[model samples]
Target: MKRNSRLSLALHALSHMAFNTDQPHTSADIAAHAGTNPVVVRRVLGKLREAGLLTSERGHSGGWRLARAPRDITLADVYLALEESLVASPSETEQDMCSVEHALAIRVSTIMNDVEASLIERLSRTTIADVRHAAQ
Candidate 1:
C-alpha cells in the first residue's frame, strides 16, 4: 500500500521538534533537514498548529515548537490533523464488476478497511517520545 509522504514528513518534523524542545525550528530549517520545500514544511506545520499539536510565533526570532510534550502527541493526532486517508479510491473499471468481481470488491473493501484500521492502530501506538527515545 502507498502511504502519504506528508505523514512521514510530519512525523519527522515532529520528532525533530520533540528532540529539540528547547529550540523553536524555522520552516526553512525544517525544510532543509527534511529535504523538502519550505512551503511544504510551513503547510504541514500550519495543520499541526491548527490541531493544537504545535505552536508558532512571528518575527525575527519566531519559529515552530511543540505545543505539548512529545509523549502526549500520538501519530494518529498528526495523521488526523493532516486529514490523510489511507485507503485509495478504486478505479471506475474496478467499481464496475461482474458477480465474481463484485463479491471480490466487497471482500477487498472489507480487508482494506481492516488493514487500514490495523495500520492506524499501530501508528497510534507510538509517540514522538518513543521515536526520540529509540534513537538514543
Candidate 2:
C-alpha cells in the first residue's frame, strides 16, 4: 500500500534528529533536506509536537527537537500522530446501496481495518533510533 508523504517527511525529520540530539532543528533546515517548504514542515511537525514526540522553541537559536529519546519513539507513534491512513476505507455513502454492494462494503471495510491494524503492529516494533541506525 502507498502511504502518505507526511509520514515520510516526519520519519525523515525524526531520523535526522536522532543523529543530532544535541540541538534543535529548524523547519527551514528540515524542509530543505526533505525538499519541501518550511510551512509544510511546520504543519507536519506541529502534529508530532502535539503528540508529544517532539518539542519546539522560539528565538534565534530555537527550532525543533525530540521530546523523548529516539529509542522511546516508535514508527507507529509517528504514523498515528500524522493521522493519515495508508489503506483506503470503504465509503460511508455506500449505505444507500443494494444488499450485495452493502455486504461487500462491510467485508471490505473489515479487511481494510485489519490491514491498518497489521501495519501499525509492524510499525510499533521499530523505533526512531532503529531507523537512524539502519541508515548508517
Q: In terms of lDDT, which candidate is strongest? A: 2
What is the Cα-based lDDT of residue 93 in candidate 2? 73
lDDT of each: 0.87, 0.94
Q: Against the true structure, what is each candidate's TM-score?
A: 0.86, 0.95
In candidate 2, list every pair of residues with a backbone clash: none
Highest-scoring model, TM-score: 2
Residue-level lDDT tens digits of model 1 in 1-136: 3233888889989999988899889999999888989899999889999999999998899999999999999998888899978776444475568889877777887888888788788889999999999887
- Writing each residue's lDDT as its tens digit, candidate 2 over 1-136 gives 2233999999999999999999999999999898999999999999999999999999999999999999999999999999999899977676588989899899999999999999999999999999999999
Worst 10 residues of 1 by lDDT: 87-96
Q: Global lDDT for candidate 2?
A: 0.94
| Backbone atom clashes (below 3 Å) for every candidate | 0, 0
Relative to the true structure, candidate 1 reaches a TM of 0.86
Note the residue pairs that clash in candidate 1. Answer: none
